[model samples]
Target chain A: MKVFVTVGSMLPFDRLVCAMDAWAKEHSEAEVFAQVGETSLCPANMEYSAMISPSEYRDHFAACDVVVSHVGMGTIITASEFCKPLVMLPRRAELKELTNNHQFETAKWLEGRPGIRIIYSDGELAEAISKSIGSDGGSIVETGTRGKLINTLRQFISN
Target chain B: MKKILAVASAGGHWTEMMLLKEIFDGHDVAFVCTMEMYRSEVAPNRFYAIPGVSRLYKRSIAVSVAKLLFILVREKPDVVITTGSAPGLLAIFFSKMLGARTVWIDSIASIEQLSLSGRMAKKFADLWITQWPHLADPVDGPTYQGSVL
Candidate 1:
């Protein structure tokens, strides 16, 4: 199984990167790749970059079986496009990870939506990782499921 | 031949704009984004990299708008679309002044309400779209269109 982790560009989300690093050390069988944005957290058992180009970002996302990401809409939507189930960690304003706490609101809003798992505390990262893989057997979302998502977008456009 | 001008900043804003790529197929699509990390992501089409603008950077907003007008005159697009932060709003506002049809698709991450730029767009846009249904409930602002995401 291959896992891709990304914290959106702009802020340094060290906590998420560190948590994933620890998780990967436990599950060495899984190939872990990360786009850590601007951070100094070194992964013990993973390959990572400070930042990546857009095309490189897309290529990594497409290749991964599962993705761990921040609650950035850009990352979430792109992950869904490849049918990659996600474990999302939202940055908190109090933690100085973000300018505001909208990510907290995003996590709350997206709770029951599709194949996403939201992790607030770092301890739950393992459970969410296993759950993401279990939900889809480490496979991408099938085309039929993706088609249905597009249908909803069409309906809204017409209305 | 319909010419469409798509505008946004480089990160989430650009991602949202790209989600609407299907609609721009076969039409002349040109992109204008803040001068940042994306060097040629909007490939195979004409793209303009303009100065960065943000609510936080009030001092530079005017120069950014002036630069945008220069592109507007040169491109002459028939339609304008943006998923915004700050640069997106200026693009749509100027395009509307040039008689282009303008659409504003607010970011899905604005979980509760529309972003401040989305609200400003309501005054002049031909169509206002929100990813959240509740933001369109009052029916006075952006229409609750499902997300392109």
Candidate 2:
């Protein structure tokens, strides 16, 4: 099985790295590809790795059996759009990565909502990834909402 | 057929509210938020900027009270929905006093933990909501609607 892990711009990558190492140690037969930081963490071997660009994100999602990510709106939606089963871990504010703790907020909101899965802990995340190997998971909502979310803004402004 | 003003601090709050954009499809809706680069980037319609307040006041409560009054009088919304920081809490309190229904939705980020704004807004708002089911009732009238966004 091939897994793709894309964590958004959050600091202290050790948590994800630890999860990946543990998963790899458990399933020595699986191939894992991941990118920890953009313009930061150096490339290392699991299967494929790079500090990828936005243009390359879809390809990365498509190539993987499972998607692991941070609790980011764009990342979450994109993972769903591609029908990639997603496992998310929120960056803790106590870790000093964000000004306030909001990722967990996003995680909790997206959890059990159609095609997403929220993993609050590293152990849960590893387990979710393990399940993805056999399970047909993930949700896809209807598109063309760009006009709708925008219209809501326009109407709110006009009113 | 009531006019609802759903106010947030922009960024995550605004984005979260936007998820429910369909609910306001026909209702009269207004948005109030703070002015920061992140807030401006989201570009809310009919946006009102509030002075960001600290947890502890340097001046008197009267001043904050006055600003709160001014906002209530200006918006005159029938209902106020907020996911607060500081400005959002003030909106909830004053909006309620003016006979508007105030619903404070705590940010969804703190699944288990209570945010500072959630704690403060709980005391004065008509309804307090949390994304987490375990937060209990923050106020006598509060309800946890799970996560709206």
For every model shown, the clashing-pair count is 1, 3
Q: Best-fitting candidate, measured by DockQ?
A: 1
Highest TM-score scorer: 1
Least accurate 10 contiguous residues by lDDT in model 1 chain A: A137-146
Candidate 1 lDDT tens digits, B88-119: 88888888889888878788788787787888
**What are the DockQ scores of the candidates, in order?**
0.42, 0.08
Which stretches of candidate 1 lie above 4 Å from their native place?
A: A25-29, A40-45, A137-159, B35-41, B55-63, B137-139
Docking class of 1: acceptable
True contacts kept of each: 0.37, 0.09
User: How does residue B66 of candidate 2 score in lDDT?
Assistant: 73
Deviation of model 1 at A101, angstroms: 2.8
CA-based DockQ, model 2 = 0.08
lDDT of 2 by residue, A1-159 (tens): 887777653344557766776677677777777766533444344643434544466677777778877776656656656778777788777766555767867676676765566777787876677666655545533444345434433343344
Chain A only: TM-score of every candidate?
Answer: 0.83, 0.79
* Candidate 2 CAPRI-style tier: incorrect
lDDT of 1: 0.78
lDDT of 2 by residue, B49-92 (tens): 55555443435445655755776687688778776666678788
Q: What is the interface RMSD of candidate 2, in Å?
A: 8.2
